[model samples]
Target: MSGIEPVEHMARISGGIVNWRKLLLIAAVTLVSILYIPDAEQLWSAWLRQEEFSHGPLMFLVALYLLWRRRVLLDYPDRRGTILGVGAILLAVFVYALSIKAGIQNTRHLGFLLLIFGLFLTFGGVTYARFVFPSLILLPFVVPPPSFLNSNLSYGLQLFSSDLSVSWLRWVGVTVFQDGNIIDLGTLRLQVAEACSGLRYLYPMVGLGVLTAMLFDIPLWKRGLFVGIAAGVAIIMNSVRIFLTGLFVEITDMGISEGFFHLFEGWVFFLFSFVVTLGLCWITLKRSERKSLGRGVMSVPEPTGREPAPMALVPVTVALILCILFLPLATYLRHLEPSIPARASFNSFPLKINGMIAEEDLLPGVEQEILQLSDYFLGHYRTGEGPPITLFAGYYEQQSAGKTPHSPRVCIPSGGWKIEDLQTISLPRGDTTVPINRVLIGKGDQKLLVYYWFQQRGTFIANEYMAKFNLLWGGLTSSRTDGALIRLSLPLRSEQEIPEAEKRLAGFTQEVFRILPAYVPD
Candidate 1:
């Protein structure tokens, strides 16, 4: 910690030769990861298919390269953080086991991160771990978020882009009406689809920001500022481009902004935002240097301490064994799955639940693939001389492999409906109370009362994260990860129409909740 320390003392130990124990530990870790190759391969497939997540694999490689570049700059800490390290290892094993049983890939990916972090503490201790903190932090971004977060974040970005684009268009003498994620420009209608949400550029920009921060000696707050600005810049630039897209359509009145123009515009904005982030980083570095000079504390250099020590045999062995032990558990859970029996088809679902018989026709744009469900029923339910309610049930045979329900909260905004109010509501379903998520979505003067809930393993869940967690738990305990999303959407015309709409949905859900297990296979 002193300036008197020699810079030469911190030189790479023996010119980058790793000791036997550490070398073997790395090999063992690699072997363990190989055992989980299926999961990694699936992720690679996702990276290839989903543009928003395309940068994920590169994040892992970049983190590895960072750690490898500074391998000799790290050293074992004074204190091992024995208790914390052991606790982390145990937590990792428990989570990895549960994830394996439950088919929750995110939790499994989380376990992989914790497992390595725990090893660092057990082997090199906390001080040694700090040397590679930036690399460690980037690991989470490698795993694409759960479906719920993905949908929500994308929806939010769409709304932001639409609002800004709409405002900008209106300011520039173009007649425009903003409808949720869509921009109506009199001559052209642009639906701010997921591509325009700017997530594709935002994620990679943040990754670059993190890498930039790691490459510099900037303060943590400044590093965080760079990351935040990267996200902000991506959104702002996307908004600008969306406005331009609308303007181009308004002026040219041609569909020239679809294929090549789209890609060209995206590249222009992405490069602009990335350059802005880099410029901000350069500014921060210049300021830090000036501040250091003004404080007169830039006189000497000090080594962080000893280079990395030889890996301890006992801790490394324990970590490796724990990792290897969980491999078979993952394999077993992969093979062990819930039973799906032949059940009454949703096609045969009664038109009459609580005296609301199914209507004869389907709503236009009622697409099932959007929900990504194995089986789904979309029908309008109505009683004689009363307002009709839309009943939808999306069933997933297995709620793993990223085949999970997409929350309506994420999809509504893109469909040109803004959620005016959101709250959890409960209804009495015989002996036990059933909880439901309620939302008031509006577009212009039209309003809708929407009630939805996750029916997982015969249990009703309102919270998104808790539903996913319980799904994983169900797979582990009962080999059942099957779930269904039940939604009741009704139009609200008059101010007094809400009470009736609520009553209809409540009465309907009370009856539907009892019979959902038959079709969803809990």
Candidate 2:
């Protein structure tokens, strides 16, 4: 071979090497950061258990594919800023440590976001422009909104859904009585609880939007519009499902609004959203030039076999190795024992909620349970059954703690006739007005009461702290004493009730206390 020909061949080989490095860099960064996603465990569990919510890992794979498909775009010549990316990594480490100290639930998610955003800004160079969709797409999944915000949103959605459903019912000429998140239709009353709020659809649909966005190359404004439309479509469709379920119940003597309807409504809404999104995308495509909309025939570049830059490989390898090291650590962190303070700090005297148990005899075949109330919370018993009743288990503390500056004093005019209002409570004795809120409103006679001190210290943010409290509260409430302060009338009761309940509650509280030590008087 000629000497000139030999040099040309070497140049091509060097270019191929450069291209490979870039791809590897992108892959390594993504792989490491992916572990930190907010619902990583749930995602993995879904995949493992073959559950309905198993589309999580597919999202990462799609992002990876998007990056690969735009290899040329990523290979663009541009300035690289390693320092900024390093700073992001450093910042993430700092936040992660702080999260551990503060007991933040999704610390890894925060870290992952910082890392991805930082890497794209710094290391990704000009390639960042091509990959913005993937970043946005992955963000919602990675950084789950804090539980406090999520609960508030869910609560709000419940209200919104109820209103929407009520409006539709009236439109169909049905008389409806609305109370909070519940709607009463002569024969049927629908409570728009967490299951009906369409939250289950939000995360997955957002993901679908991201995937759809990546597949289509449209102007930013149009893309935003499409995404908004898709989300709106999901929500609206869910509202309609809520309305239709009510209608179905009213129309059919069969209880279609209850069990299977709940399960079927989810799928129906999902399908409706999918169809609407596709329809919108098609309309948008038809309205714009095919090429401009990125829906036209695309050109395929020649396989240059260009390798990636050597300098990029070092960092990519380092990142992958570091991520491999941290994966186990992240898992360990998630399972770490709750600090002792959060665990043992249930002794905020004056008012305390003691326990709860299901009383089948009180209202046979329906859920009948009572929650012990303390003056700690100026409160009301939330209507529900089982652990961490609300999505925002954290918020109850602030509502219950008597620490908020301007919280309302909730009182039940009549104590539902089950148990007479005891003027004085002797357990954990203290001189404080026990403000209680109890209600009986279910097929079977069901009653719950919440009593707490009505006072406030400052602005409060409920979070994992509330979850810890819930763990203890749930355990204690389920326990029944042979002759405890509250002997729940049971059809068939067991002797191992109070001690077992206390033991379980203690264990759960201990788990939380590992993260948060009980507030001992410092």
Candidate 3:
């Protein structure tokens, strides 16, 4: 009788403490997430490392907390969503299969989220997904913003930030000249770089706004208004940050706004923006006179009637079988479909082309990473009297993931150079005209003329978006991801006009064009 009493007590404790079916569901989800562990770790690393995605790590904890709070809704026992669960799981597996070869981390994140959705459906059918849907929708903080959107958004934002900052400078009675993204404050030149474009802040603000609304459990209309206002707030704050830095530099020594100090300023302003966001949330909540949805680390969600057993067996079994089969299938699809296309090798590039002499130079460590190279040649060319023009060619036999050429639009401004102007120009190459992106970057009185273009598998792309789309198209069709970035820059002497610079660059291109094809294979 004592043994039977203990057995009954143990059974009772198990039932009241934690459901056995919930344990099974957790175990199944864990097993599935293990397959996507590497991808999750990648996002975590990006969130922790990159300044742009600094707000990313917060989402993981937020998602867990959200699930924990709404734990009551997770219990529903209907096999109705099993087919949909299997479909969602299969969608995840398929996306992984497709995106793995290309190293698209965004797609991997999407796949992992889909896997979670599948688990939710398997456990609680459509009921849980419907009830706790905000958690799924409020998760853009972790995923990196898509590059396709960056092209237009970054350009527009950079221009707006620069123009707005210049206006603020004028309002402060500072003599400032505006040219595209460059702001000449007579004392110090500020280049509103792409990083300063406020996309980073915009992404996080929207993400935080959504989470804030969820936490505050505010009205639907008010929540949307908050998010929309948050975007404008990000832009205004970023612009204000730019103006403040310039004003401080003009008033004090520019040294205080250079290097580490500049980075610190960026951090402080972003923190300020976050605080302001919280303040807005607080004020809105106060006006409504509503208490927070819940408090404490282990608060239980609002009750949602009786708990039911989860239907997990069939979906979990099918998902595992499909995942096992996908591994070998992915290996075959990514490799056997495309052969390595032939291209010109950089081995035989000449040091002396016509009368010009080329002196080779080594790339810096960070620069080497940007130019992910199968082969590369960096040279400074001079005739005898005039200034030397640098030529850098980076060739990639394959560009998988983000191992493509880094654009100067972002890198130049980071290096403390302000872009005076940038445009696309056509350089006459033999019977044809090759279009190239031309830019003028400066700091104080110093200026440089730069021309660059992407020599893709067989096409020359001046536009960054064009290059990206072509790469994507090629990767999808033939799996040929070979490309190269050819860049040339000339430092202007104390006395050199636009015409002289253009004439000199055009003349050099004519001489060097003959030797380029042999190195940058077709």
Candidate 4:
């Protein structure tokens, strides 16, 4: 009985010892994580204000939560020694530094991955890195696909959705005509633009699904089913929203479909989608047994009732040093890049209007008033007229830069007014051609300048790879002011060109304004 009592006492002593080392390591990690987290916070705030898609802190929180739940797994015997763990941490630091220097997209994304890797090395070692490699699959979701890929995909989606909706409406005995992203449904027209592609919700919906499947320990097949279901729900909800918007436009004379429908209905659909997702998650949990498993089995021998090793204190101290050093390091690095130029401004004249304007006032004897209205809306206004009218000339010019053909042109067909016209013009640059579009409004004396320019041959949009890389290079590889100029030419009738032109411009714009209502009444 005395020998057994000694063993029991030892077990009791082991159980009573505090895991101070782990606690210190955790404290250190939390402090460093705080430093790394601020960048994501700004990004998240910006994302909330935007109508476009951007997944912010959601991924970070999920990763942290999962890691916390798997804490016991870290106690398992690591095949590699602590030296290997330290080496892994160093390598991750190098990767993070390189990614930062390169100004890579989703810098936070790479940082988070390296963070997870570093912690594993600093604590869990080689076997943990191997086991957690599945997290790499989530990386692609973080760095959004290249802009070219997204743009093409979005454009295709817009075209497809427009055609599909138009065809469906026509089949249902409604008069419908397909035109690019717009669908004409007799009394009202519907646009299935890029935003209507359900892209804004894609990342979150898919992300939540993935997290749910992993959390609940659902079978891979069921996980896929859940994701597919979520995607279907997103698509169906988007279509219903669009349909209702179109119906509202048809039923009401107020044009509520354009603005109010977009603003409120988006929130409504998002809410509905969220509820559907939660319901699915509940159903998943009902079928799950090991889904809520707390943690992995611990392999470490229990501690005796002795003080923890000084190694516990080391992590906390190092973490504090890092936190203290990080801000200065980041600020110095920021100075290495040149400041981005401020955005240009456009001057506007004061004018007032009461109702929608007639197209004939601007077109001057256009046979098809509806078609003329389309042209007017699509046309750009200049102080004086010579070149044809362009609506989105700036967009076209940006797109046309750099191509095999000496001159590139894009023609847009307006089905509402039934006229097709070339909208973009490409002009030759050094080795590449710059695309330009001219928009003209008001006959004879009034003309407006709208120009788009790109300095780099291959890069067109702000989000392009070359563009982002060029931004990092501080306009060294690419010109900083490498953009096109928008010019408006107004012909002067008198010797006082500037004053006379300003007066005529003021009067012309004011007249134009009076013709068109400033706000749509609903």
Which wins on TM-score, candidate 2 or candidate 3?
Answer: 3
lDDT of 4 by residue, 1-522 (tens): 988997875454344322443454466567556656755564566457544445545655656555554444444424343455555455555545544554443554566566555554444345455445445444445445434355555555555555555555556565666555676667766667556766666555666556555554446687677677666666655665665566566567546677756674566667678678768656655434444432222122333443222232343344345545654665554456533333222112122222222221233353232111111222344322432222221211112112101111111222121112224455443466544443322223433333332223334332234444543453334223223212223433433454554454344333432322221000
Worst 10 residues of 2 by lDDT: 480-489
Q: Which scores better on TM-score, 2 or 4?
A: 2
TM-score leader = 1
Q: Which of the numbered candidates is closest to the native, going by highest lDDT?
A: 1
Candidate 1 Cα misplacement greater than 4 A, ranges = 1-18, 74-79, 82-84, 126-132, 259-261, 287-314, 360-367
Give the alpha carbon lDDT tens digit for every residue of 1-522 in model 1: 576455444444333423454565577567667866777787788789877677787887877776765554344443467446657878987887787777777777778777767766766666546545557788776577776777688878988889888888888888998778777877667788777788888778877767666555556787788788787887888888888877878767555766434764556667877898777656766755544532221111334545555445566667767777777776776777566655677877777887678874543443544456787788888877777888888888777755888777777877888789999988887786878899998888899999999887668888888887787667767866778888888888865888887887777777887777678764
Report, for every candidate in turn, its global Cα lDDT versus the true structure.
0.73, 0.46, 0.71, 0.45
**lDDT by residue for model 3 (131-220), tens:** 445566666565875554554577677877888888988998988887668788777777776667888787787787777666555567
Clashing pairs in 3: 344-521
TM-score of each: 0.86, 0.59, 0.70, 0.54
Task: State the number of backbone clashes in model 1.
Answer: 2
Order the candidate numbers by TM-score, best to worst. Answer: 1, 3, 2, 4
TM-score of 1: 0.86
